[model samples]
Target: MTILIPAMTQAENHPVSLTDDRGKTIELAQPATRPAAISTFGADVSVALGRQPVAITTFGLQGVPAYLGPEMEKIPSLGPRHQPNLEQLSRIAPDLVFAIRRYTEKDGPQIEAIAPMVAMDLITLQDSLDAVALAGDALGRPQQAREINQRFKARLDSLAARSPGNRTVAILTSGGETPFVYYDHFLTASLLERLHFDNVGGSPPNPESGIPLGYRISLEALLALNPDVILLLPSNRQRGFTVNPVWPYLQAVKNDQVFEVGQHWKESAGPIARSLVLDDIERLLLPDDTPLKTSSR
Candidate 1:
């Protein structure tokens, strides 16, 4: 429904030629049946389209996410996303591997030795949808992908129409002496904005590096934002950072609106991940009396 998926683009044909976000043309001898994803994003999209990856890119000590629940236990790990284990991947012998465009640029030549790779950029919602549609073609599930896309667009439209005004939110990234305030280039803040939540912090200055969680700001600047809701990343309720003696006057801390969520909201840029993020927000923002249509998938 978003039209991000070009009507003329068809990957099912032999010698499929598709250009990734980096403008690299991915030429496939045939559509990949047994595929592999170089990151959690690719793996999640695969599962959403009703096909599981033979292997998923791992994150060293961090490991991959359990997006598929019980099905997660069945999938094998393929090492780190950026610097994958080519030896292990060769054994898996996948027909193709999906990768983040930026990370795979330098390693393209080497990765192709293991299996042809298709790189994608997950910068915005449309980008994620495009990647999903591409995956649908590769997995021979184009109809399923279109249905999911239509469903997602409807859900998003519903939220935009129903989102309340003046409910400002601020996101704090965990790590460093002072946790960073995330505005843009991250799923949580961006998606919340789409749902009509006013993000007081705004998006980060630069989004490509993916190193810094967000721009670190003094407590005074954060207080100036006066956000009604505060979301903390990589946080736990037991840590009790919100209840600390730091700021008794902060509205969010005083009102107990500070919440901690799993890493999916902060990282893992993909279509399925966005859907999961919307689910999380609807749970938190919607009220029992709020007369909005439920958009849960």
Candidate 2:
């Protein structure tokens, strides 16, 4: 029942118009039937709205997301999420394009020439929620979009109410010598914070460049923070930092609190991705005996 195909709402009667995160207003004559997803958020939202994208960018060179099922593999790849092949996009001839604001801003004009483009700023939790609603409007599923948003908010509140305590944590990635620590405002960290986990990375020193994902942290700096739990989002199984001389001294390491998470943690702005993230948090952080409602989609 989580995924339903409701009847078309107000979008059918009038031209669909909404401003994207880049502050650019895009108007569609009718609901888009052949949208291209430059970011996974668009694809995720599309599927939730009972539709599939005509084309999509790869999930960090892994190709289309297998978690989205076998159907996703058949979609034409526009290449990497950052800089998709414009030629391929042009060939696909998508009616609309959903792009990540930071990645597509420089090439917005080129994309617009091919089709209407909506550049989304999918950084924070609010950004994700708003993006879903905006995408719903474009896809002509506004009512379903509102229902999804409401369900997500209600689920988030339920999880927060069951938070154990304020345990200090850090979300790290990289298979190399230094691991990148995420900022608190990063979507994953933001979710953990809502679950009452204190992010050791905290907010950035300056807000000049808007919200940053994370920064590389040295072993010495990481040791100083000494978070209670360390979530490792490695590119591969080979974690070079674990072999370092200073690795054993960290509190999380000493207590065996370091956990390796999946790729979903990297791009978790969509409805399905967010739900899976909550599932991971509950499975990894909560005790086996802990009784809580599952958030899996």
Leading candidate by TM-score? 2
Instruction: Compare the candidates by lDDT and give the number of the best one.
Output: 2
Q: Which ten residues in a row have the lowest lDDT in candidate 1?
A: 1-10
Local distance difference test scores for all models: 0.71, 0.83
Q: What TM-score quantifies how close candidate 2 is to the native fold?
A: 0.91
Clashes of 1: 2
TM-score of each: 0.84, 0.91
* lDDT of prediction 2: 0.83
Runs of candidate 2 exceeding 4 Å displacement: 1-13, 288-297
Q: Write the per-residue lDDT of candidate 2 for residues 185-261, one digit (tens) a residue.
A: 88899999988799988897654454577888999999999999999884854778879999999999999999988
What C-alpha root-mean-square deviation, in Å, does candidate 2 show against the real structure? Answer: 4.7
lDDT of 1 by residue, 1-297 (tens): 121234555656544556666666666665677888887777887888777788888654547776656676677777778887777788889888888877677888888898878787765666677887777766667788878888988887876666664589888864544557875555567677777678877756665544344677666677777789988766433333344456567788889887777667755466667787778787877554665646442
